[model samples]
Target: MAEPVRVRRLTDQEGQRLRQIVRRGSIHAVRYRRAMMLLASGGGNGVPVIAQLVAAGEDTVRDVIHRFNEIGLACLDPRWAGGRPRLL
Candidate 1:
């Protein structure tokens, strides 16, 4: 049997902060934070549960968690730097 994905626990402060974001209904940060909280709380703790809850794909949920873990809140906003500029 394959090992299940380990769910990360959110501190009380983190949980509260995430809840606030969800309540604000920003239509931007809310979705991301909600997913983060769900994942952290072991809600579906897998690709399918997260996808169903957030109406996104498994890959998306996985990416979001990874980005948040890597860069903190900045992950909420996607950054497109565009391709490398050509040096003339």
Candidate 2:
């Protein structure tokens, strides 16, 4: 069977930064959800529960986790290039 997904242990700075994001400011809701997911996973929540908690699908949750694992905290701000070139 496949192993469950989990975030690596966060440094004190990373944990603090995540807490700040979760607590304040007017960041996009997507960032908020992503922060929550990482924080919860770091605290031992699994992908399925994190998905339900954030109202997202399990696959989406897995993707977020994988992104964070691959690129650290930047996963919170996915840079989607602006919508495909408009078909003139």
Candidate 3:
């Protein structure tokens, strides 16, 4: 079987930051949701549980976990490119 998707061990600072975001809330909903996902995963929750907890899709939870594992806390706020591409 494939390994379960999970967040890696969080550093002290990363844990604190995630907690702060969850406790205090963030201006960006994405940040808040991502933080919650990470915290839940860190707390040993599974992807489905985290998804239900945050009212998000399991894929989203998995993506956040994967992103967090790959890029640490930076996954909290994704850089989405907006607007149509310019054809010069």
Candidate 4:
């Protein structure tokens, strides 16, 4: 069987930041949801459960976990590409 997707051990600072984001919440929905995914995974929740809890797809949860592992807290706020610049 494939290994379960999970977040690596969170640093004190990362844990605190995640907790703060989950606790106090963020105006940015994506940031808040991603924080929840990481925090839940750190607490031993599986991808499916985290997906249900966060109302995201299983793939999305896995993606978030993988990204967090790769880039630390930077994964919480994704940098989406904006559309083409306006032609004035």
Candidate 5:
């Protein structure tokens, strides 16, 4: 079986930043969701519980946690391809 995923330990600054985003309610919805996931994980909630609390799929919660572990707070706003792909 695969090991469960979780966000790494958060510094005081990172924790404060996430709380600000969640409290202000002005950040992008996607970022808000990601921040919530990391905060819940840091608070000791497992992937499944976090998914239910956030009303998201288990896979999505897992992805957010893993992404946060890899990129820290930057995972909140991901950079995706903006333009259409060209046929090679």
Candidate 6:
């Protein structure tokens, strides 16, 4: 069997910070933070485990992890790039 992915553990302060984010952040942000926390803490280390825990797809979990690793916390926010600009 393939070795399971190793997850980094969050510090107590980091856990508290994540809880605060989940409590006060926007819907998208909260969801992402919660998932990240779960994954980071080994609550669910693999994509399948995380997906089942969060009721999200494996791809979604992978994407969130990748985004957070690459871009820090800002990836939690849902950015809707504005539609095409109107010509003056």
Q: Count the backbone clashes (under 3 Å) in each candidate.
A: 0, 0, 0, 0, 0, 0
Q: List model 4 lDDT by residue over 1-88, tens digit each.
A: 9999889999999999998988887889999999999999999999999999999999999998999999899898879889998899
**lDDT comparison, 1 vs 5, better candidate:** 5
User: What overall lDDT goes with each candidate model?
Assistant: 0.60, 0.89, 0.92, 0.93, 0.88, 0.61
- 2 or 5, which is superior by TM-score? 2
lDDT of 4 at 13: 95
Q: Where does candidate 1 clash, by residue pair?
A: none
**Superior by TM-score: candidate 1 or candidate 5:** 5
lDDT of 6 by residue, 2-42 (tens): 65543456568656666666566536755655545444535
lDDT of 2 at 25: 50
For candidate 6, the lDDT comes to: 0.61
Q: For each candidate, C-alpha RMSD in Å?
A: 4.7, 2.2, 3.1, 3.1, 3.0, 4.9
Ranking by TM-score: 4, 3, 2, 5, 1, 6
Residue 68 CA displacement from its true place in model 6, Å: 0.7
Number of the top-ranking candidate, with TM-score as the measure: 4
What's model 4's lDDT at 74? 89
Which pairs of residues collide in candidate 5? none
Minimum summed lDDT over a 10-residue window in model 1 is located at 35-44
Which regions of candidate 1 deviate over 4 angstroms? 27-45, 82-88
TM-score per candidate: 0.62, 0.88, 0.91, 0.92, 0.85, 0.58
lDDT of 2: 0.89
lDDT for model 5, on a 0 to 1 scale?
0.88
On a 0 to 100 scale, what is the lDDT of residue 7 in model 1? 40
Q: Is candidate 2 or candidate 3 better by TM-score?
A: 3
